[model samples]
Target: MNKKQKKMLIRIAITAVMLIALAFLPLTGIWRLLAYVAAYLVIGYDILRKAGIGIIHGRAFDECFLMAIATLGAFFLAVWTKSGDYVEGISVMLFYQIGELFQSYAVGKSRRNISALMDIRPDYANIEKDGKLEQVDPDEVAVGSIIVVQPGEKVPLDGVVVSGNSTLNTSALTGESLPRDVAEGNEIISGCINMSGVLKIRTTKAFGESTVSKILDLVENASSRKSRSEAFISRFARIYTPAVCIGAVLLGVAVPLLRMAFGADAQWVDWVYRALTFLVVSCPCALVISIPLSFFAGIGGASKEGILIKGSNYLEALAATKVVVFDKTGTLTQGVFEVTAVHHNELDADKVLEYAALAECASSHPISKSLQKAYGKPIDRSRVTNVEEISGHGITATVDGHSVAAGNAKLMKKLGIEYHDCHCVGTIIHMAVDGAYAGHIVISDIVKPHSAEAIARLKKSGVSKTVMLTGDARRVAEQVAGELGVDEVRSELLPGDKVAEVEKLLAEKSPKTNLAFVGDGINDAPVLTRADIGIAMGAMGSDAAIEAADVVLMDDDPLQIAKAIRISRKCIGIVRQNIVFSLIVKFACLALTAAGITNMWAAIFADVGVMILAVLNAIRALRVHNL
Candidate 1:
């Protein structure tokens, strides 16, 4: 508990003891009233102060004002009637403070859950200077500077490992318990702890642009984006508070006047007591506090699982997702092309690949990189000369004095060489050496192990449709879509084409449901922005995609998509449950209080009891690990 909560606890204890002692004492009249007033001031002075401030500021329609008015009126009625029954007013304030303390503790719990992520912020970066290690603020480290990460130190910036290898504890970043292994040439992100070995890294991004910085920014600003439900509650409270206050005043005056007109006793004390009871029961504290707390707990719970929801609004929308559109590469698939097969080799397979890798060595395309990776050897670029790259075709270069042409069938047809087409479910590269058909290499992107299960889970989680959008060939796209169990596939699409497809899906779906687009490429940013919710693969995703996305999966696992949806649905379910429960109990209590069927003690339960239950229910949004 915080200092404020501890102090409130002490005040509540003192007030309770005083009430208990006063109940036993045979005190009378002015002495009894003075004792009760002293207890009230001890427990509720802040509330009275707040009400006074609200009235001064021209905003006197809040719960504190309602509470102040109800208790003060109860005390005044007791004195006017000479009943010496001030216990009712003091108990009302006492129980209200108890409810407030529970709320403070619950809010503190939610904040702690999110603050766990804040521990990832690094204190310093280890930069080598003058043959010694110098610790400096991460912001002071420039891109391209070499930094040393010793054992048990966080990688302070996004960079590439230039020397040494280590096991990284990535739980803070990805929430996965397993440690990740990194070696030379591997890209390492910030906020991962080096667990085993020392590593020298060449910084690729400054501190502000690093992954940790972006995630911190996302978390800190999350609460500012309120859900529609929260906005509605805000508007409702603004109108509801003042309207109830007016109704209380009318009940206190109009009911008594009606009795006098009927030639019966006015019974002003009885009618005014009912009015005070009405105000207490209609305070709206349960609805005002629990709804936002539910969303806050939901966001905190999701962050614990490496799902970064940008706002409560996005969390609310995720619960209603009907269509989940996915970009194939780097989303559902590995996005890293690998040589799956080499066939129809006129020359040796290794020799054909060698010439192809050498010819395409100068190109930086993914396919070219795959070829080079398949070669499994360093390229001696000096041996290759007279290189030419054909747009939409391939590359031509002289390797070891032999003319090598490597590309698709279009390249072969354009070169007038007879090439044999291979029936393969992948991207095939036809190779020609010395103007002769040598062979072809097949490269294919592997699908993620969890992609199919992710789709299945989405369906089980109430998602009606799943679609895969990709710029890959129709054959490849169809194969991947089939493997992943997607309900629809839009293949061979450009970046703009993706937007049109999502728009079409948006029009086709019901207005009540939302469509989410998931992608990890720079080109995916536009479509990500156009969709109802954008989910990005943060591990290897382009910065543009992450920045444009509303939800980011730090581990880049497709299964997290389903998990995120489940978390949101559970949270929103709790929110609706709290709203319905609080309203039902509140209105029931209000009707009974106005009819004089319930007393001020019952009014305390109607106000504080309902709020405590709603807050307890709101805290359930934090327990999402099972979901």
Candidate 2:
């Protein structure tokens, strides 16, 4: 327990002991009244002090005021009647304190869960200088600095591994139990734990711009951006509290006068007691506290699964999502090219790759990288000479005294060489050796393992349409869409085209149903911003994509999109439940209090008991791992 919780427990213990001791004592009259007063002060001194401050500050229509007035009036009534009923007055304060304790405890528990999820903030970053390790604040580490992460250490910043290999414990960051194996050249995100082996990393970003810092900032500020429901509750409390207080006062005076004029022996004190009871019943604590708490907990819970929601408004919007559009590269696909098939002459497939890899060795394009990767050997640059790149055509180079060309069909035609059409889908690079058609290489980007599953889950989750948009060839886009079960495919789209497509989708979508667009490239930023909800693949996503997107899937898992929607729906459901339940129970109890059918006991339940139940219900938003 925190210090405040411990202190509250001690206060509760002391008050319970005193109440028990009084029951056994033979005290009466002034002695009994003094004992009750002492118990009340012990358990409720803070509440009484706060009520006094509220009154002095002209904000006396709060729950503290109602509680103080009701309990104090009970004490004075017992004294005026000369009855030994001090225990009832003290019991009211004691029980109210107990309810407050329960609230504090519940709020604390929810805060701790969120705190644990955000515990990825590293205390220090280990920088290596002059062959020695130095511990420095993460903020002091500069980009391109070599940082050493030992076994079991949290990665302090975004970086690429320069040396060594290890398995990362990303459960805290991604909620995945599987450990990710990392090697040289692999990029590692901050907030993951280095489970084994030492790693030398070159920092790619400053601490402030790192993934961990961004997520922490997002989670911390999420609660400040309230949902529509939460805003309504705020406005409701403002109007409801003062309105009820004024009504109670008028009822207290007007009711007794009306009864007296009717020739009935109306007791002024009884009517006044009823007014106090009315004030207590109309506290509005449940609606005021639980609606926002539910949203806060939901955001925290989604963050545990590596989903960062920008605000409660987005979370609310996600619940109404009907159409989900996705970008092809880096969002649904691996976005990495590989030499899938090699079709060539009788010279041999390895020979074709050798010519292609050597001709493209001087280029840094993705196709060049795939050629080199397929070659699987370091190039002999000395053997390559007179290299010339034809823009949008191909690259021609003299390798080992032989002219070689590696590019598309246009390049072969420009060289006056007749090339055979591969006719197959994907990127076809036709190669020419010494002015003769040598062969072709097929490079394709493979879809992610979970891409199909993500689409399936979205369909199962009630998404009406799943569309894929990309700047790839029609055949390739159609092939990928078929494999992933995407409902529609739009290929060869420029950045501007993507935004236009998203706008069209928005127009086609049904009323009150939102359209979400998921993308993970710098070019995807415009479309991400244009859509109703933008989801970015956080791990490998460009900074522009992450910044423009409303939600981020930290590990770049497409499945998280559906999970995010599920979480948002659950949170909205809980909020509606709390609002309906609190309002219905409150108004019913308020009617009972005004009708004189319920006493101070029912009023306490209406104010504090309802709040406790609502708070417990709000905490349910945090239990989203199962969903």
Candidate 3:
């Protein structure tokens, strides 16, 4: 337990001992009253002090004030009636303190899950200095500086591996159990564990701008952005507290006076006791605590599932999303090109593939890799020379003493080589060898395994429309859209055009519905920011994409979108249930107290009993695995 909880436990223990001692004592009159008062003060001194301070500050309508008024009035009634038994008053305060402690414990447990993120902050960074490793504060490490991450050490900053290889334990960041293998040229994010090997990393971002810092900032500031339900509860508490206090006063004073004027022997003490009971029942602790707790638990649960919701407001907004828009490249497709087919070859298909691979051997483009993979043989670099890369076209190089040009239709037109369009749906790389038309190879990106399933799940989850916007050609985009079964497709869109498309959809969508856009590129940042809910691919997405997104899918799984929405909906449902149930029960108990149909015991049930039940319901938000 924390120091605060320890202190509360000590107070509870002392109060319990004193109450037991008072029960065993044979004292009478003022002495017995003093012993009961001592027990009450031991447990409730803080509540009394807070009530006084609140009254002095003109904020006297909170639970502390109600509790203080109710318990002290009970004690006063006992003394004025010449009854020395103040046990009922002391029991009320003691039970109330016990309830408050229970609430503190519940909230602390919910917060502990989110607080696990604190372990991600690295204490030090190892930087290379003059061929020796020097440990420095993470804040002191500069961008572009080389940092060495040892085995079992946390990656202190986001960077690319310059040397060495290792399997990274990304469970803390991604919530995935499988360790990720990384070699030279792989980019690694901060907060992951370097599991097995020593890695020499060239830092790409400083400590403040790193992924870990951004995530921490997001989680810390999330509570300040309240959901609509939480806002309503705050407004309700402010107006409800003061209004109930006034009602209680009128019930105590005005009702008895008016009854006396009517010639009825209405007991003032009885009316005062009823008013105290009303005050206790009117306390709004259940709604005040549980609403925010439910949302907090939902966000914590989402984080554990590798979905980062930036705020409770966004978590609530996610539940209203009826239209989900997607970017084609990196979002739905694998974004890795592979050779699909070859046609119109004058020579053997192997010879044409060999020629293209040789011409593009020195290049690092996806298309080049596809060609080299199809060739299935290493190129003799000595046989190739005089390589020239034509921007937006392709390349020209000398392969085995023959001049070979591999490019698009534009490149063939530039070379004056008459070439036939492949009429294929995939990207066609046209080729010419020794000024003769050769075969073309078809390359295309593979759709993600979960893309179709995710779209179907979103539809099942009540998403009204699924749309895709892409910079790819119409044929390619349409093929992907058809395969994924999206409702609409907008192709050949630039980054600015994507933002416009999202805005257009935003305007055209139902007024009650929200538009969510998912993308994983730096160019998609603007659109991500423009959408109502921006979801980013956390694992392979760019820093800009992650920064602008409101929701992040840590493993880059599209299905998590539906899971996130379900979690939010469940949390909001719980909030509404708590609000309606608590208010109804409280109002009913308040009416009963005013009519003399209920007493202090029922008042305790209305206040503390409802709060306990609401807290239990709020804890259900953490159970998101089944959802």
Residue range 39-74, candidate 1, lDDT tens digits: 999999999999999999999999999999999999
Q: How far is 271's C-alpha from truth in model 3 (Å)?
A: 0.6
If the candidates were sorted by their lDDT against the true structure, best first, what order would they fall in? 1, 3, 2
Residue-by-residue lDDT tens digits, candidate 3, 504-595: 99999988889999888466888888889999874432567567888887777788888988998998899889999999998999988999
Clashes of each: 0, 0, 0
lDDT of each: 0.92, 0.87, 0.88
Which residue pairs in candidate 3 collide? none
Error of 3 at 134 (Å): 4.2
lDDT of 2 by residue, 16-84 (tens): 999899999999889889998999889888988999999999988788887888788888878877887
**Candidate 3 or 1, higher TM-score:** 1
With candidate 1 superimposed using the best TM-score fit, by how many Å does residue 127's alpha carbon deviate from the native? 3.1
The alpha-carbon lDDT assigned to residue 460 of candidate 2 equals 95
Candidate 3 structure lDDT: 0.88
My TM-score estimates for the predictions, one after another, are 0.96, 0.95, 0.95
**Stretches of model 2 off by over 4 angstroms after superposition:** 128-132, 540-542
- Output the worst ten-in-a-row residue range by lDDT, candidate 2: 537-546
Best by lDDT: 1
Q: In model 1, where do residues sit more than 4 Å from their true spots?
A: 381-386, 539-542
